[model samples]
Target: MNWLNKLERKFGRFAIHNLTMYLIGGYVIGYGIYYLMPNLLNWLTLEPGMILHGQVWRIVSWVLIPPSGNILTIIIMMMLYYSLGNALERTWGAFRYNVYIFSGILFTVIGAFILYFITGGFIGLGIFFSTYYINMSIFLAFAASYPDMELLLYFILPIKIKWMALVYAVMILYTMVRGNIAVRVAIVASLLNFVIFFFSSRNMKPYSPKERARKTKFKQQSRPHMTYPGGARHRCAVCGRTELDDPTLEFRFCSKCNGNYEYCQDHLFTHQHVK
Candidate 1:
């Protein structure tokens, strides 16, 4: 099956697959207004004390809370999150993508729990819900792959992902230094997620049997199609297939001729001159 179909089959339209984004978005919009309006979020009747008391719901509610009260800023953040988040979901697959996001959430919760237990219910719980770093990690992941990809700034000039990520990183660093303890902790937790996922990404899914077979077939079919740098490791100069990625793949000089070739395993004897 095609890659698109494979992705859809694995992650499309499941409630568990995407509920966190919606839940976080909705709660943040609600409670952020509550903090500003004072009388809002009455339904939740959120209490700082209850959070410290180990309320299970806080762990989930914390994800939905937005740090800012400005409508325009929230809109911008949401737009960036949705656009970049969807792109990442497609690239990482549903399970791995979900794990990356929820793992950050878990870290934030753990940080808050530790603080709460230590201080004996004295600190604020609202700060634990900070998602800026979570969002930043997602954006950074995108920047990692498409560093040069550009987006319109205010629908005007184009800006590269790497530059945008750098600006955000600096802002977060500044905030960690200037903001309250909760903000600093949130930043640290989020950053921890980003670093752990990037340098030590054991989360990527292994190739499935079918995919392995398909890749093997593709490798073999393209093996005789090129010449390479060395007789043993030579690859199709045209296709760029080589044993560099995998050493177990068997390669032949030519499928038709019995004569041995001097090309690399990637393109032992397969070549055709263009007219």
Candidate 2:
């Protein structure tokens, strides 16, 4: 995860903003491709065999393959995930959200390759890899972050998000138990980001969005008081520990955070990014 901190510092400027919209846009194009030139989509799947044979475009183009569904279902799915993705981006900030999304895509690609090699390229299963589970992860993350939030089932019945998440967990568990190897790999790879980022996120279990806003404001107001523990110039934003607390701790400022946020060596890579 520290790799993310280093990466943010080095390439955070290039991170996509409102990344969810772009993914939705990709899905729109995919739907167009699906309806207009269905055969071409086969060429765009994440086929490691074809990739090894020099059709490297499959690595990126696979994302354009929208999840299989009727038009109405697809539209509703897109709308729901777009809202969830934006919520995550707002809370995690664009850089971390970009990392989360891109990481899921990356992991899926890697899983495809691993499967290909394990099966010795006999499967020729390009169609197996898609962004379906990646999109599902957005829902899981939103549920974790806003457990108490309610959504309308069928746009009629009100239900809490956490219950929906629990349902999802049961479904995923069932799939893992009953599905074949490809399903298992896809599920694990795609949802790995949820497992990692959800747990590591900001220690935010107790606070609501409004409470977080208040706390953020309080943090900004308390900036001057940050230099503590024998007036050390650098104090970790996460632990509030300074040079005086531990002489061995090296400190650095996060270029990705909105302000002059410094972190000690232990937390420099792991802290929740401040926007």
RMSD of every prediction: 10.9, 9.5
Please give the distance, in angstroms, between residue 8's alpha carbon in candidate 2 and its true position after superposition: 2.7
Worst 10 residues of 2 by lDDT: 200-209
The residue-by-residue lDDT of candidate 2 on 1-275, one tens digit each, is 56667888999899899999999999899989999999999889899888988999999999999887788998899899989999888876788889889989999999998888888885567767788889888898888778899999999999999999999999999999998898898899889888888676555532446666787998888767665657787788889888887889899989999987889989999998998
Q: Highest TM-score among the candidates is held by which one? A: 2
Per-model TM values vs. the true structure: 0.60, 0.76
For model 1, residues 1-275, the per-residue Cα lDDT tens digits are 24434555766555255534674567567665776875544323223467546665755655555556577876776777787777666555565566677778788767766656556776445544566677778888778756788998888999997898889878877888888776676677766777776666543333333444577787887677443456545444446556764677555455454343333454544565332
lDDT, candidate 2, at 65: 90
